[model samples]
Target: MTTLDPYLAARIHLLSGLDWDGIADPEARSRFDEYGRDPGEWTMPDVDVVDHAAPGPHGDVTVRVYTPPAPAAGALLWVHGGGFWGGDLDMPESSVVAAELASRAGIVVASVGYRLAVDGVRYPVPLDDVVAAWEWFVRERPAASPVCLGGASAGGALALAAAIRLRDAGSLLPAGLFLAYPVVHFPVPALDDATAAAMRSLPPLLRFPPSLIEEMFANYVGRLGDLPPLATPGHAPLGGLPAVHLVSCELDDLRPSADLLARQLAEAGVEVRAQLAAGMPHGHLNRTPTLDGVDRSLAHFAAGLRALNGAGEVPPDVA
Candidate 1:
């Protein structure tokens, strides 16, 4: 049996103990932000950062650009995940990951602070933010060179959706996609018997009740019937998606959706790679400071970025 990382368990427990019902409250949101664990950072390296607000449909999206030492391998526009309700660019996943990818992969990392669904923010608002941020990056950087797109959880779904949208518009498609436990299946479905049984057996910190997801979906997509394949991507056609690198958490209630997406992408003849964080919880990459699982996921992300940059090949390594 795989042992759960104690740090992750404690973090999950802490989050679970919070008055989650108050998450939509401003003060409660602040408390949740403060209570979050320290997002890990990469070892120090020469990196130049420029943070600014770019034009968007609703307002402006904040974007942070990280430039690392020497020649650049390629560029990536990374989005942060927080269930479409919360999260920011300063979080470890965005800040630290960008720094690390720039240093380790020699890629320019543009971390986006897209409009979050909380504070009365809505779906298309967040999606609009990502589109604006990406457009700005492509315009500012090399339009000839391909840019990879990446995100975790909510951000991941947006990344894929945006890529598809771009394809439809005959715009430049994302060179690749990095999705970490993405919430693609909007209008979250009821967990099947087997998955439900497995989730029930998980620790309180790890167990994801269907009610929680239902609330998130309601808060995100106000009208279930209005959900298009672009908004709720689980059922979206995977034919045109770029090579995908999807990471799933073993204990996540969202695994089934990820698995479905992976299989569908493969069936569509898209190059797909999937990895699971063994004994990890949902949002495992951000739940702990730096665990073995986090390292493993990051390594896969780095390798994928290199391949997207045409620097190497990512062989079939899904499990």
Candidate 2:
């Protein structure tokens, strides 16, 4: 049996009352708020942060722009993750990721708050909000810099969906794609024996059953038959998308699909870099603030952005 890593076990224990059902429970938001919240002091780096709202398909959407110390030459549009039902710009996930990438990666980082599924918004609407933020960033913030798109979990999936929408709409393609353990399919398949066993070893709140995960998918994509390629990037054609950098958590249930994305991208002759963080669980980007694995993952994410964004070199270090 694969021994459960104590680092992941401890983090999982801290996340109580978080499950598929808890997302809709009266206390669901509170639990999600607590689970996704960052607990440490967040000091602003030597950069400028602008918080403002832009027009969206449904309503106004909030976005934060992080200007690096140096002149902005590259830009990354980052989407937050919440299983499609939860997460926001004010969450610790957004604040920490934006600061780390902007200061370390040396590129302007625009963290977007696309509407959530919990607010009665669905697939394309959330995706529309992301594109809206990207448009606003291009027009108002950093138009001259080379651009890349990235997201975490559902946000990652949305990033891909937005890219496809842009492609169909004849918008310019992004230089690269960086996804952190993204949810690519509506009904993510069941885990195999080894992965399922590894997941069971974790705490209850961390182990998501296939049924519960499907429910979350239902909340995002209303009709199963309407599952288009844009809804699930794994099943979509990879010809026109930018080079991909997919960083998946080792113990994450989404690892299988992420692997499929890498394989599909590669088979389609697209440049791809796929890395799995050893012994780490999904959402490590949000959960582990100071661990070496988290640092490495963030650094890799930045590296992908830098490769596409030009020479703004920053080495990986523990934060």
Candidate 3:
């Protein structure tokens, strides 16, 4: 029996006490209406928020732009995560993540509202929305606004896939990648027997069955063969990709995917930095209130963006 970390254990207890897991999307949205209200919230005296809309495959996608207290030298193109089925642009966790990145990285943060798969749009739909958002950022913002794309889980997968697409299209590559527990495989591979068994025995955050994962993948892929490599960066050739900063939690079922991608990227000669937050579970980056690991992850994310922008060496404290 693997025990949850003390902080994480308490968090699990708290989440179980809530109605978040079973509520309808609309009802859940109403309950957690504002960003930075839950775990991602940290005190950042210097931060600004603005609402922006960009043209996407699905009409206009709303984006919440986070401006750092300092003058921004660049912008971060951020995608929010919800298993490709849930999440909105202004969700509390996403907002806190964006604001943390903006404040710590000293850059502007554009939180993307990509189309959800279950809500109508499917796999490539999210990718199209990401690309459109990127286009809008480059077209509407300063040419010098170096853009780095990042996201958590599904959003992270989209960032990698989008980067691959941009690279193939001969488009300007983002300065770097900030992937937090990204889903790399399109039909996300099944959890190994050990991982699957462990997950079944763990707390809610640490438990994700292989069967459920298969369902998610099937839903997203939808009987498509030769799905674009841009839909799953792990399948794409790594050559010519930007430097990557990937964060993975040890208790996450997707840690294997992150580890494999990191090894592959490094072997292919991409500048890669992989950090493993031991004992933390999937989406730990969203639990800023209880986990020291979340704060470190955000700080590292900011530092990685800064490094790509020629802002100096990554601060040693960020690990």
Candidate 4:
């Protein structure tokens, strides 16, 4: 049996008994806040990090740019995941991944700070922000620079949706896509027998049941009925898109969705490479990069970005 990493198992044990459904609860929030506190040991490499305002229909969207010291191999427009309700550019999944990719892959990384699905905000708003930021980034970068689009969780949904919009508009499509444990299916696919059995041991906070997944989508689009394909691109047509590099967490409830997407991509004649992060749970990228699994996940993304620039092979450290 594939076991949970000891470090993550211990952390999950500490977070046990807290109701993930009550994330808005003061106690739940407090516990999560404490758990999310990061040590200051992790440092960014020698790279220029800057924040810029990209014009958006709703307002100015924040796009954090990370530039490597040497010439960039390519560029990536990254999106962070929070089930459509939470997450920001400051999250480790966003900022740290951008910094690591910028240094490790020798590429420019633009992390988008799209509006969350809260208050009266609904579908197409966050998508608009990402699209706007992508357009701005494309204009700002060199004409010949190869650019890719990537995201994790809900951010992955947005990234794929944005790509669909670009493709439909006959606009420039990304050279490739890097999706990390993406939640692209609205209903979220059902897990297989072995995977389902494995998920039974996960902490409540780490499990994404079907009901919870549905509720998350409802909150994002304002209703579950007649959902937009772009909002959950797994069921949408997936032809003519660029090559994809997808990471699926072994212990994640959302792995089924990512697996289905891989098959769909193949059926649609799109080149795709999917790798499972063994012994890892969903949102592993949110953890400190010092962890072996986190570093490997980042390296997978770095290798994908490097491939876009015609780099020969995956680096020795990726596995």
| Best-performing candidate as measured by TM-score | 4
Worst 10 residues of 4 by lDDT: 310-319
Angstrom error of the Cα, residue 268, model 4: value is: 0.5
Candidate 2 lDDT, tens digit per residue, 109-213?
Answer: 889988888757677788889999888777774455688888998888889888878887899777788888888975676667887777876655666567767
Q: Give the root-mean-square deviation of each candidate in angstroms.
A: 3.6, 3.9, 4.1, 2.4
| TM-score of each prediction | 0.86, 0.86, 0.85, 0.93
lDDT for each residue of candidate 1 in 188-212, tens digit (9 for 90 to 100) = 5555676566567554445556777
Cα lDDT tens digits, model 3, 1-319, are: 4444556554454343234365456644443333213444456447888888888767887778888766467888899888788888666458878887887778888889878888555778888888898888777667667888888888998989889889989998888888998888745555656656656646443455566666666667685467667666798899899888888776777777787888889888998887767566787766553357677777778788877678868544222
The per-candidate count of clashes, in order, stands at: 0, 0, 1, 0
User: 13 in model 4: Cα distance from truth in Å?
Assistant: 2.0
The whole-model C-alpha lDDT of candidate 1 against the native structure comes to 0.77
lDDT of 1 at 13: 45
CA lDDT, every model vs. true structure: 0.77, 0.75, 0.74, 0.86
lDDT of 4: 0.86
Best-performing candidate as measured by lDDT? 4
lDDT of 4 at 185: 84
Clashing pairs in 4: none
